[model samples]
Target: LQTIKNHLVEDMFASEGFRSDLFYDVQTRQNIVDVVKKNGKLKVNDATMTRCDLLNTNGVIHVINKVLLPDHHIED
Candidate 1:
């Protein structure tokens, strides 16, 4: 489970598109790490217990987790 989580984090870092974004940038990665440190629930170590969603944002509103994270990119 931990291995899967590690792989997912590595994949996110490896993704060129994701790495280019400001919102999902290095700061966000650090924020996620901080969140996990502060809250155990945010730490995802198993595929079955973990999910992610990226939503289109308009100004301040961004919907996420309506369902599981889409395997493909969400059209902006």
Candidate 2:
């Protein structure tokens, strides 16, 4: 389960049309995505991006108002 979850999270790095690695949604489930599309803007979920792209020695960090999930409902 950990292996599969790891893969899912790895894939979620591209959901908002960019790369990300952090989620802090209070209402989102671990494997559920809440999409947001309004005013000609589209994001994977309604998550408000608080911060993004903080470079680190091992990787980058991103902060969002909601959690993210991989495309489980899409046919891949």
Candidate 3:
């Protein structure tokens, strides 16, 4: 879905140093989704990164513990 793909950025966070990136969520009509690294933990809004830097022919993939949906669809 566009919402999920929207969460992905073109940058490789593994070696680039995880500061922050802005993504768009089409489902919520939101223009900015925050992906941040704090205390050595990478978080996509609220989802914590479980596995990271999966190398492939396409690009690197980072696995998160929770689903990255819009705020309205996710519970606090």
lDDT against the true structure, each candidate: 0.25, 0.41, 0.59
lDDT of 3 by residue, 1-76 (tens): 7567646666555724655442323222333455655667766667788888889887788887876665533222
Model 2 earns a TM-score of 0.35
Residue 16 Cα positional deviation in candidate 3, in Å, after optimal superposition: 5.6
Would you estimate the TM-scores of all the predictions?
0.16, 0.35, 0.62
Can you tell me which runs of candidate 3 are displaced by over 4 Å?
19-31, 71-76
Using TM-score, give the best candidate's number.
3
lDDT of 1 by residue, 1-76 (tens): 4322322332232122232222221223122321121122222211121333443232222122332232322222
Span of 10 residues, lowest total lDDT, candidate 1: 29-38
True lDDT of residue 27, candidate 2 = 27
lDDT per residue as tens, model 2, 1-76: 5323422333334225532433322222245543343443334454454555555555555565544544432121
True-vs-predicted CA distance for residue 41, candidate 3, Å? 0.7
Residue 72 deviation, candidate 3, in Å?
6.8
Report residue 46 deviation for candidate 2 (angstroms).
1.9
